[model samples]
Target: MKKPVAAVDPLRLLVAILLLLPLLALMGFGMLWLWQSGYLLYWLIAMVVCGVLGYGLQQLLVRQERQLLMNAATEPNPEWPPSADAVWQQVEALSATCNPEDWPLEDGRWIWDLGQKALETVAHCYHPEVDKPLYELTVPHTLLIIERASRELRRDIAEKIPFSNRLTVGDLFRIQRWKVKAEKAFNIYRAGSILINPVNALLSEAWRHLRERSFDQARNELHRWFLRAYVCKVGYYAIDLYSGRLALGDENYAESVTPESKADLEQTEQTAEATNEPLRILVLGRSNSGKSSLINALFRELKTVTDVLAGTTQALEPFVLSREGFTQALIFDSPGCDSPFFDSKQMLITAGSADLILWVSPANRPDRQAERQFLDALRSYQAARMDRRSAPLLVTVSFVDRLRPANEWHPPYDLTDTTNIKSANITAAVRAIAADLAVPAEQVIPVCLLEGKIYNVVDTLWSAILNHQDEALRIRLMRCLDAKKRAEDWVLLRRQMAGAGRFLRDLPEMLGKRSEH
Candidate 1:
C-alpha cells in the first residue's frame, strides 16, 4: 500500500521560502543603490532600448513564418474539385467580412464560428442541395477529418515556425496577463515621473505609444494568419469529403507502396516493386495495325504471336509487365476495334479500368472512320464519369517504313528536318493520325514495329510511358480505393449481422426482465 501525501509538503515549502528570501533582499538592495547612484535614468533608458530591439526582432521572425504558412494555405491540392478556385475565392470573401475588433485575443469561439462559415462555403460548391452537409457525415468520418486537419496544422506550425512547438495557448494567456500588470505599473510610474521630470516623461510616453501601436498591428496580423490557416485546411478536407475524394480505409491501400520500397524499385531493377494492385495498361487499335509487334517490342522480345491475318487477337489478353523504371503493371492486348463482331460495350468496360492506353495505328492505313467513331464513344463514356480520372493515351503510328519513300529505310529519321523526303512523309503521317484521333501531336510517336528493325521502341516509346507513369499511378490509387471501399462495406455488413444475431438471442430474457420490473 502507498502512503498518501499532502498537496503541499512542509519541507519543500520551507525550502522554497528560504530560496526566495535572498532573491527579494538582493533586489531591494539593488533598488536602493540605483536610487542613490543617480545613474538610474541611464540604466532605465538602456533597458527600454533593449526591449524595443527585442520586440522588433521577434516581429520580423513572426512575419517570415506567417508568410511561409500563407503560401502553403493558398495552394490547393491538384485532386481538388473543379470549383476549388471559386471555393477559395468564396472563403477569402467570407474572411474579409470578419472584423478583427470583434475577435478578442483570449477568446477562441470566433474561430469556430468562422470555420462553420467556411465549411458552408465549401458545401455550397460541392453539395448545394443539402441544407446541412456537415451533419451528413458519420461520426467516425467527421472525427477522422478533424484528426487529419489538426495533424497537418501541427506539422506545419512546428516545422515552419521556430519555438512554436514550445508554446501553448496557456502560455499565451499567461503572457497576456503579465502584459496587463506591466501596463498598470508603467502608468503609475509615468504619473510620478511627469511631476519630477516633465521632458523625460513626455519622451517615454511617446515611445511607449509607438511600441504599443506596433505590437497591436503585429498581434492582429498573427491572429489573422492563424485564422486563414485554420479555415483553409479544414475546408480543404471538407471539400474532399463532400466531393467523394476523401474516404476511410484508403491509408491501408496506400501503405502497400512505402517510400523506401518505391525508391528501391525506381533506382534498380533488381528490386521488385511492391503493390497491392498493379497498374492496368490497355492496348487498342485496328486489326493488323502492328499491335502485337508493338507489345513484343515493349517486352524486348516476342511474347505475343503476330500473324499476317486480321482478327488474330479475338479477346483481351492480359500480360504482367514488371519492367525497369516502371511500376509493376498488367498490360492488356485488347481486340482490334475494326472487327465486325467487336462489342463496343465490353471494350468500354475495359477502358474504364485502364490506367494507361497505347493506341497502335498503322502509318500506311488511310481508312480511320471506324477508329474515329470508337474514340468518340470512348471519350463520351469517360466524360460521364466525372469523379474518375481518364486514362492517359499514347498513339503509336506504326509501319512508318511503308511511307512515301518506301525504298529509303533509315535507322535515324529526324522528323524536325522536314527537308528529307522520308522524315517529311513520316511527320505528315503522324500529324494526320493525331488530327484523326483527336490526340495531341506530341503524344503520337512514329515507330516501325517491323521484325529486326524496331525504331523508337526503346528510347522514344518507352520514354513516353515513363512520363505518363505519375498520372497512371494516380489513376491506380483511385481504382484501389474503390476496391477497398467495397471490401470495407462487406466487413461492416458482417459486423452488423453478428450484432443483430446476439440481440435476437437476448431479446426474450430482456422482455421477461422488463415485465418483472
Candidate 2:
C-alpha cells in the first residue's frame, strides 16, 4: 500500500516556529549569565516570563495566520494546481453528452450544467468551506463558466437552425422565450458588459458575418465566447430595424403634440373663417428627414434648419405666419415621427385636431419604416373620423435638391414648381409610395425646403386645405381641442388648490400661541 502524504498546516507550523525561536535564544543567554554571575533567581524569573510570552505570541500568530490563509484562499483569483484542468475536462465531457432537446420543459438544465462546470473548475482550484462539498465553488467563477457555456450553446443553436425556418410561428415563439431566458442569464453573469467595448466590436464583426449568410465565419467569431454572449441582444435590434418595427436614426422635432399646444393652436384658429383658419399642419417624418427646413421654407423665415437630425425637437413649437389680408396660420413643428418611443395615441389626438396633415418624407432616402407608420396613422385617423369629413392629408416629398448628380451643384428647375420636370419626377415617386399605401396620387406634392424659393409648394398646400369642405370635421376638431384645453386648466387648478390647502394648514402652526408659557 502507498503511504499517505501528511497534510501540512502552514499557519500552525509558522506560528509554532515564530513563538519557539526567541524563547530558545533567551534561555541560552540566561544560562550563560547565571553560570558566570551565580544569578540563579534572575534566571528562574526570566524563564517563567519567556514561557508566558511565548504562549501568548503563539496564540496571536496562529489567529493571524488563520485569517490570512482564509482571505487569500477566498479572494477573487486563487492559484490552483493541475487538478483544476482535470475538473474542467470532466465538465466538458458531461456537456458533450447532454442535448438541449432532452432537457426539462423550461430548457434550463443546459444552463444548470454550465453553472455546474464553472463551479467544478473553481472547486478544484480552491479549498472549500469545511462543511461544503468539495465540488462547489465561488459565485464569480461559476458565473464565468455559465457565461462561456451559454455562448457555445447559443452559437451551436444558431448554426444548426436555418434563418428561414426560424421564422415559423412555433419556432419564433420558442426563440423569443429562449431569448428572454438567455437575457436573464446574461444579466446575472455579465451585466453592463455590452457598452461599446472591445467585446462589442468583436460581436459587431460576428454580426456582419452572420448578416452576410456566412455562418461558418460567424461561428468562428462567436467561438471567442465572451463576445457571442451578446448575440441575442444584437439580434433583437437587428430584427427591429430590418422588420420596420424600429425606425433607425433620429427625429428633428417632437413627434407627438401636447394637448395644451394643440388647444392653444386650435383656439387661435376658431377666431377666423375656414379659409382664414390657421392651417394647424403637423410636420412629420423619420429622423433627419428635413421637417424643420420645410417649415422654415413655408414661412419664408430661417426659423429652422435642414441639417438638423432626428429627435432634435423635444417639444412642439407653434409658429404663426402672417399672410396677406391680415390672415394668419399656426404651423406646429413636431418631433420626428418614426421614433421607437413614439406614441401613436398621442399623435392621433394631435393630428385629429389639425386642419391639414402635411406628411413629409425625405426625397433622397425615403425610409420605408417611416412611410408605413405614416400611412397607418393616416388610415387609422381617417377611420376614426368616418362620421366627419376627412382632414386633407398631403404628402410632401422634401429635399429634391439633394437627389441630383454629383457633378451638378444644383437642379436646373425650381423644386417647388409642380410643373417642373424634376418636381414631376419627385411627384411620381411620392405617388408610387402613396399608391402602395392606398393613398390618392393627387394628394402627393414635392418640395425642396432647403431652397429659398418654395412659395409654390406653400401655395399648393394652402389651396388643398382651403378646398376641404368638412364643416363637421372642423367643428369636431374644434370641440376636441377645447376639451383638451379645459382638462389642462383643470389640472392646473387642482395644483393651485393643493398649494392653497397646504398654506391654510400651516397658518395655525405659523401663528404663535398666547404667552401662557
Candidate 3:
C-alpha cells in the first residue's frame, strides 16, 4: 500500500549543496577577516571551552540514563532459577565489553546474533555440563517464546518510540546512506579549509574534536543500551521457559480469548462444572475419629451422619459447604480408615483432587498406625506428580473435652496457661497428634466437636482454612490447567485424524485426474 523510498534524489541533493555553499563561503570569509584582525585565536579558544562544557553535561545525563537501563537489565524475576543471577551478571559483563565500532551500525543482523548469544548464555546456566542445551526447547515452546518477545517489542515500539510506526526498514537504510554522504562532504570541506588557512583550520579542528568525541560517546552508549534491552528480553522469556511458566498451546488459546469472554473458557475446566465446582476439602480419619461430626460442626448443621460406631460413612459423601467467612468448598466425608471394606484406590483418587485435607484425630486415641500409614502413602502419591502443588493438611484434634480431668468441662481454655491441667492436656494431645502425623504443631487445631460444646471451629479452625486459601487456589489452578491441556490435546488429535481421513478419501480421485491430465 505504501511507496518505497528512493535511494537518491540528485535534484534535492543539488538544492541542499547549493543552499550550503553561500553560508560556507560567508563563514570562510568571516574567519579569514578575524584571522587578519588577530581575534580568531580568542574566538577559537571560547568555542573550545563551550564545546567541552556541553560535552561534559551530555555525559552526565547519559550516565544517569545508562544506570537506569543497567539496573533493569540486572533485575531478576522471582521464578528464575538460582543460577539466573549469575547469568544476568554475565549479560551485563558482555554488554560492558561490547564495542560499537566493531558492529555494523546500519545492518540489523547483529541484533539477531546478540539474541542467539543471550539464549546460549541462559541455556548454559541451566545445563553447564552439556555442550549445547538448545535441544531443551520443544518446537511449540520455542515458537511461544518468539511470539511473546516479538509482541512485547512491537508494543514498546508503538507505545514508547515517537513516529516509529511510520518508519520502514528501507527508510532507515536510506537515511543511513544519506548520513554517510553528509559525513564525507563535511570531511572534504574541512580538508579544503585546512589548505586555505592552516592556523584557523588547526584551531577549528581542536574545537570540532571535542564535539566528535561527544558524538562517539553517545553512539557507544546507545549501542550498549540496545544490547542490554535485547539480551534482557531474551533472558526474561528464557526464564519463563525454564521455569515452566511458558506453556505450549497456551498462548494461542489465551490470545483467542478476550477478557470479557474469559468465563467461557473458565467454564470448560473440570473445576468449573455445574455450580462451578467448589474447592474440594477431603476429610480423613480413623474409625469414630469424629470426622462426620467435624463436618457437621463446620456447616453449623447436621450435614452428614455422625455416630460413635465405626464405618458410619460407608462411602465418600460430598456436601457443598458455603460459610459466611470461609472459601466455598465441597467437604467429602470418607469411610473410616479402620473399616475392613475401605477402598484405598478410591480414597487416593479423591485425595488427588482435594485442594485441602482435614484430618480428624480423636484426643483419647493414642494408636495411630492406620492414619500414619495412609498419610505417608498419600504424601508419596502427591510428590510423584511433581506438576501439581501439594494440598495443605490441617489436623483437627477432636474430643478435646474427653482428654484429661473429664469432670472439668470448661469453655475458652487458654493452652498458653500451663497451670490449667485440662488446657495443658489438650495442648499436649494436639502436639502428640502433630508429631504422629508429621505435621506442624501450629497446623494442628484442638477442638471439642461435642453436640453442645463446639470450640475453635469459628475462631481457630476456620481461620486456618482461610490462611491456606491462597495455597488451595494455586493447587486448584494447576489441576484445572492440566484438565484444560488434556481437552486441547484431544481436540487437536481428532482434528488431525479427520483431516488425514479426508485426504485419503480424495486421494484416488486426485490421482485419476492427474493421469488424465
lDDT of 1 by residue, 1-517 (tens): 9899796678865675565556545545665677689877886788678868876886786677567656766456665434465676776776666656766657778756766777778777766698786566777767766777778877877776668988998998999899887776556556656655565566668777767776777667766766676777777777667656676754656445434334434543423544556677889999999888998999988779999888899987766677888878767776789886568998998898788999999999999999999999999988877667689999999999999879889779989897999999999999999999999999999999988999998999999999999989888776766666666778988998999999999999999999999
Q: Which regions of candidate 3 deviate over 4 angstroms?
A: 1-145, 152-277, 323-328, 342-349, 403-429, 508-517
Candidate 3 Cα lDDT to native: 0.75
Worst 10 residues of 2 by lDDT: 73-82
lDDT accuracy of residue 240 in candidate 3: 61
lDDT of 2: 0.52
lDDT by residue for model 3 over 320-390, one digit each (tens)? 67778665666778898889768987788778877899999999999999999999989898777644557
Give residue 89's error in model 3 in angstroms.
13
Which digits, one per residue and each the tens of the lDDT, describe model 2 over residues 462-493?
A: 56655552532353344343444455458767
Task: Tell me the lDDT of candidate 1.
Answer: 0.77
Per-residue lDDT value at 68 in model 3: 55
Any residue pairs clashing in model 3, and if so which?
none
**Least well predicted 10-residue stretch by lDDT in candidate 1:** 258-267
TM-score of each: 0.79, 0.37, 0.64
